[model samples]
Target: MIDLARQQLAHDADPLVVKVGTRCLTLPDGTLDECQVESIAEQLVRIGAGTTRRVVLVSSGAVGAGIGLLKLPERPTDLPSLQAAAAVGQCHLMESYNRAFQEHGLLAAQVLLTADDINDRRRYLNFRNAIRALFEYGAIPIVNENDTVRTAELSRTVGDNDQLAAMVTNALRAPLLVILTDVDGLYDGDPADESSQVIGMVEAIDESTTGFAVVGTHKSGPVLSKGGMLSKLQAASIATHAGESVILANGRSPNILVDLMAGEPLGTLIPGQGGRLAERKRWIGSAAMPIGALTLDAGAVEAVAERGKSLLPIGIKAITGIFDKGDLVSLIDEAGVEIARGLTNYDSSDLGKIMGQPSEAIADILGRAPYSVAVHRNDLALVRDAEGS
Candidate 1:
């Protein structure tokens, strides 16, 4: 048996973000399973009842639940159809959550977000404030992508709710992210292949195993099922890198949420980097989507990764794509591996002229210097290995 008390204490001492996937919350027949939803809700309420630690739920199933309610045979293939289903399903989904939480004497608030919402500066802060208010008011905020009005450019974009949950965890400055999926945890290979084994822990998320394929249930497709195990791994990497621990566990078992909060060793635990990033940097690192790429020399890579220095023009080897000043861009090594992401103070056109120049030379070349470094250290997030360390 898992040590429930210890685990719960650990989770309580740390910031915890719980993400419930569609497969776990839905039945085998691709229908919203009320029993499981109620069970999970009860467990969450129990966990949050007396704890000072905040709990935010990033849930999937707006479309799946909608499908069940609309009696659709399969998930829609087109954008409009999917959006329509999501529109109808989001209401039913929230209703189910509200009803379930009420049974536990809790009130649940609905928060719908698009990728663009967090990707923008003003909107991100607004969304964060709204969620914080909900928590302060003693309500559990159930978040999902706003698919109804989201365009392909904005809405159909986030890899999955798993990724969104990670972003939310970072945005909220949570200490831990608990991802409850249908599978037991991450495995070295396919779990049903008879020879695959669950990887008990991950220290770093690297390239060799980063793209593991995610198998899906009848209700979801391999890629569409909340980004599969691979996306969850990526999400874990993001969260853990920002100094937050993550857990990927099976949600099918009875009382699993309660068990996890109780501190039971029921799933794979991804340890976090020891110290937390400052709040502003955390948002820039996790929420800012890179609009372009900046290829760097070996020295620049070392400076940023090891010495924690700002990215200077002297280190830039080449530039790719067009990004405006203040846009988020990726810093890549010579091998085209992304080392980190940061907001640039110069536009692509300006960077092209100032590449490989000293900070002092910026004013000379452009007639006026904006700031010294192209990407400041305070605006960067280093990419972790395939297994989150």
Candidate 2:
């Protein structure tokens, strides 16, 4: 088992985010299984009942839950049709949650979110505050993506609910993230490999760890959700960076949540980086999707990744995509490998003109920039990749 002495593990984890994927939440018929929902609900209520502790459930099954009820032949391919399903199913989803929680003397509060709601600072705070208040009032907030209005662009922009759960975990500065999926945890090799073994713990989840997992597309996904093992690791990176523990376990075993609270390591424990990021910094790092790219020279790569320096205009060699001054952008090497991500001080148009130019030349090119730097060190977050898979 992983050590949790620093996290006050002897007692209940104060704040926990439990995420359940669509596969385990439904049966083969693609309908919302009340037994599964109630079992998970009972587990959550038991955790919430612990003194000074609160629980949040990030459920992803609205569209899939609606399919069987609406008698759809299969998952909808078009955006509008999928949104229609989510609209109908979200009601039933909440009703299931409310009824289940009520049985255990708990209230389930529905909180729907979109990308815009999370990216905007004021809106993000409002969402966070609302959920915090719910916990204080002895209510469990059931969160989900507002799929009713999202199009294809939103899928790439907002990512799936797995990433959304990571955002919520950071927004609340929760110490634990439990992502309940069909499998037990990350495996060393293919699940089919008889010799494969589940990796008991991970210090850092990075690109190499992700290389082994299978990603599920809409058609390839089992029933209703877009998230696969790939999305779970992506979410793990975000939560772990914020200095919170993450567990990827089997949702079919509802007792896993209770077991975790009782100090048992029943899943793959992804340890958090020791440096716990501030709330706003965690938000900036995980909330916004990159709108553009900046290819860094070798010197800049070493400086940012090793020396932790600001991205000066001189180190940038290329710029791709169109992004505004304050938009989040990818910082990559010339070979197109991502090194870091941050909010840019210069717009894409301005960056193009200033690439390979000296810092003093910024004033001559764009008349003047918010600052001489392309990306300030304070606004940056390095991407950690595990050594040798």
Candidate 3:
């Protein structure tokens, strides 16, 4: 069945995202391997040149490379030190990429980005346009997290290049995202167990898939970088939910990229959401983090999910957490299941007074004029289920 799906999804014309992990690019001694870099460069050039195919390479290895350059004993713990390492290593890393691409008569463009690029609508569009333009110029983009200055700007977790690549795949609407990693693919259980088998095709990365797969990984302390099987799974979930496929394969294997393009099925193939959500909705449902949550009555739940209506004050049973107007909030049901997420029109305090009231009553309760609805239909998007997929 996985084979049949692979054959059906063999879209050579669809743009591909090739994310090279630190493990693939670093040596056993915790240094950047020139051989691996050269090998990757050759593979990328082979994929991009002599065809109209466009490839986005989300490469990870900056920090590891930095450690070797600075002769550090282990990974740095301080944010400032990590940024310094990123600044130093990013230069040498790109230089290696440039030289390697040149050998195959191709050009490699370095694109440094932060989570803000994806969170901000305008900036995200600009980044998307730049990638498209790179394709027109017949150049492959080497994307990496802007680790140097992102700490202060992004409040969420740090160093998840796997998730970044997934976002890039969604932004480009690429049919496939190949996460080149150290492992062969996702196994049914622990790889060391003989009973565990590599699951072939994943239609949806829901609880079943995630439960069966490992979420965190570390071996012999830190080797090259922080990306593990769990990070890849998170990335796969994001991309697959956004209507994209993901391939997790062993980067150490020769011609892996070529084989995948040929539909050889060398990795675990995770299928995308059956249909594409509007780009704006994908951004809203994903990209931005929810600052707060709103609990809704059964009526409000029906209105939002079944009738495709905006959330109103009368339907909201309670408001939890602090949130301001124009901020994103999760709309949950009485059972505490998240049905949807959306940008709220009123702050939590304001909504608290307006809860269980009619739209016209909002103005009288809040003193100031209020938006007609608590959450406009245009600003709302459905969550997959109670787990908030």
Candidate 4:
């Protein structure tokens, strides 16, 4: 179904977040494509020329560019090799973007981020302020993961550009997140098959919607990157859950950004699901990476999920991983589904001692109870609702 209202929401959205994948930024041989970069930069400049809407571009191609420069047979699998490639290619990547945007009479600001940037609350706010300042100066902010420093291949926090883009969208509260990839859109069947049809609109991203991602799993993206349709869908889920719309379309398509702004149904649209979350809650749900998990009992699950109660020590049945006090932790139900995430009052060792014990028993068990509750309701962010769970 084509809904003009939703399309209008995307069309009129200020501060649009656009994510361009490696396939769009790199040639088939994994070389950085300067012409493609220019074309994309031109389109962005055209879209932001007259409108007050601020455009932020999240790009992926450093490793691919390195591969081409090094004339590697394929993408490197080792962490050291990947890091070395990123270091070598990051300079080239920024140079291309700067050259491309400068031709359109615009300056491009390079922002490299890692998981620590999002995990730390102060740094997260700092990043937001920096982006705002860049917009004020009439410069386009181009963001990418700090692959040279981050071991994303080993542990995924700023996993890929897709996830990084989603986090940025949530952090900025951008109304629309446009993801540009190689595919036309999410298909109902195998993308390579002629019978597969591109879905026009998605109201929400659920298990059924994500199922479409696996339909054509065999035909993944080029060897330049590890991201695929599933990653894009995960990105969509993040943005949509934060009350932001997403448009996944092919970047190679002609006049795609301009046409999208004109309210043409050119891509698969996943509209925002509910009201936008507050800044703190958005950070908790979308940005904070859980260092540990607390498994809740049946009663605790019902109380937290339905009654909106805080997580008490008595509710916790098990704890996994070593984490310190004030660290972000996941709250999972009996079925191992994550219900919420919040800052914990006690460390993993202390929580282990106080598990299934009442608030009165914490002081007795741990010498002193710093906080009565394990995780206060104010600090907790529910990822799934009761019905959804």
Candidate 1 lDDT (Cα, 0 to 1): 0.79
TM-score for each model = 0.90, 0.91, 0.90, 0.96
Worst ten in a row by lDDT for model 1:
215-224
TM-score of 4: 0.96
Worst window of 10 by summed lDDT in candidate 4? 380-389
lDDT of 1 by residue, 222-340 (tens): 22243577778888877887888888889898888777777777777787766777777777777667778999999999999888999999999999988889888888999888888
Expressed as tens digits, the lDDT of each residue in 1-389 for candidate 2 is 63565235525346788899998788777889999999999888776664677888999989989886898878888888899999988999899999999998888999999888887778989999999899889889999989997767642357889989988988888888889988778877676666777777877776557765652212333456778888888888877877777888889975877777777667688877777787766776666567788999999999998998999999999898988888788888888887788888988988899989989888888887568899999998775441112
Candidate 3 least-lDDT 10 residues: 215-224
Q: Residue 46, candidate 1: how far off, in angstroms? A: 1.5
Query: Which stretches of candidate 1 lie above 4 Å from their native place?
Result: 3-9, 154-156, 207-226, 384-389
Cα lDDT of model 3 by residue, 1-389, tens digit = 23555755656436889899988887776678888899988887776556677888999999888887877887887889889888888887898888888888778899988876776678889999999999989887999999888785445432488989888888888888899988788878777667777776766666767666653233654655877787788888777776778889989999888777766868888777668668887777755567688999999999998899999899999888887888888898999887888999988888888899999887788777648899999999787531334
Candidate 2 C-alpha error for residue 45, in Å: 1.0
Better of 1 and 4 by TM-score: 4
lDDT: which is higher, 2 or 4?
Answer: 4
User: Where is model 2 more than 4 Å wrong at Cα?
Assistant: 1-12, 154-156, 192-195, 206-208, 215-222, 385-389
The per-residue C-alpha lDDT of model 4 at residue 225 equals 86
Q: Identify the runs in model 3 with alpha carbons over 4 angstroms from their true place.
A: 1-4, 152-159, 215-218, 221-223, 317-323, 334-337, 368-370, 385-389
What's the ranking of the predictions by TM-score, best on top?
4, 2, 1, 3
By lDDT, the candidates rank as 4, 2, 3, 1
Index of the highest-lDDT prediction: 4
State the C-alpha lDDT per candidate. 0.79, 0.81, 0.80, 0.87
Cα lDDT tens digits, model 4, 40-139, are 8999988888779899999999988888888888899998898888888888988999999998888999999999898888999999999999999999
